[model samples]
Target: MARNRTRAPSSTTTTATKTQTVRINGARVKITTKAGKVTTKPALPLEWELQAAQVASLRRLPQYQRQFLLAGDMNASKRGPRAQAQAIATGMTSGEPDLRIYGEYGRLLMIENKVGQGRLSPAQKDRHAALQRLGYTVLVIRATTTTEAAEQAVTAVLEWLAQEKGKAA
Candidate 1:
């Protein structure tokens, strides 16, 4: 029988720890690996975080309570394939703005919320254009953090309402 030769495993094996940043929920999250195990943590505020802040701030305003509305079938999209298809069939249009505010005299403002380097998708652009053509005002609000986004959105809404108020007066 031929002699079998097997090399022994190295005693000094190096386990390299790797780190990387990835985008999750529109937030930058850091992922680290150690000894073949992985860990992830958010490095920035998520888009939903900003949106929730905006919603909370807007809801606090008495005037906003009645006029503010959250649009889009985002929940349906998250539910699964059947729900998405059903939503589409039931007139859930794509690229709808995340929020809408109805002002006096039938004026409207649509808000597209974004975080970080987010930009309008092609479908969003088209939908916004259509709304504009129908005499609606659309605003794209973007910020890196939740605090900034809420403040910016509130300020913009108040200013627009002020302008509308001025026009009426």
Candidate 2:
């Protein structure tokens, strides 16, 4: 019979170790690492960061104005002849007018608003023509609500439109 032989097992056991490190401007930063995971703290609050970005964007525009226009079923038809004529003949494809006025004789008036400092560019004139072609008299009003300036621009536009309509009639 042959003598039995036995071998002793090694005492080492396999285990996973995780290492964590942080960096700041090319220098190693202190970071707590555990279970092979790492995370960094945010430097600024999200809300504050977003507000700062928005303010920066708004500052780029020197003048800002909002235009309101008449709302009608005809305005809703994007493919209609009136809409096409307005866009092709007068450049006002967008159906928004600054204000809409109804006259005693069933006439309609459209107003476009702009800031007082805003100049009437060629593009703006084109838009005005577009609104006129749609049979809605167009006018541009300065941006102000003070007593001296309040509503004067709109009044002037109305008078002009009335005169034009009278001439046409």
Supply the TM-score for candidate 1. Answer: 0.72
List TM-scores for all candidates, in order: 0.72, 0.32
> Lowest lDDT 10-mer window, candidate 2?
64-73
Give one digit per residue, the lDDT tens place, for model 1 in 2-45.
Answer: 99999999898678999988988877898999888999987767
Compared with the true structure, the alpha-carbon lDDT of candidate 1 equals 0.79
lDDT of each: 0.79, 0.47
Which portions of model 1 show Cα errors greater than 4 Å?
A: 1-29, 32-42, 66-77
- Candidate 2 C-alpha lDDT tens digits along 92-125: 4443544454443456665454444556556657
**Residue clash pairs of candidate 2:** 68-97, 68-98, 69-97, 90-130
Worst 10-residue lDDT window for candidate 1 reads 68-77
User: Which residue pairs come into collision in candidate 1?
Assistant: none
- Give me the overall lDDT of model 2: 0.47
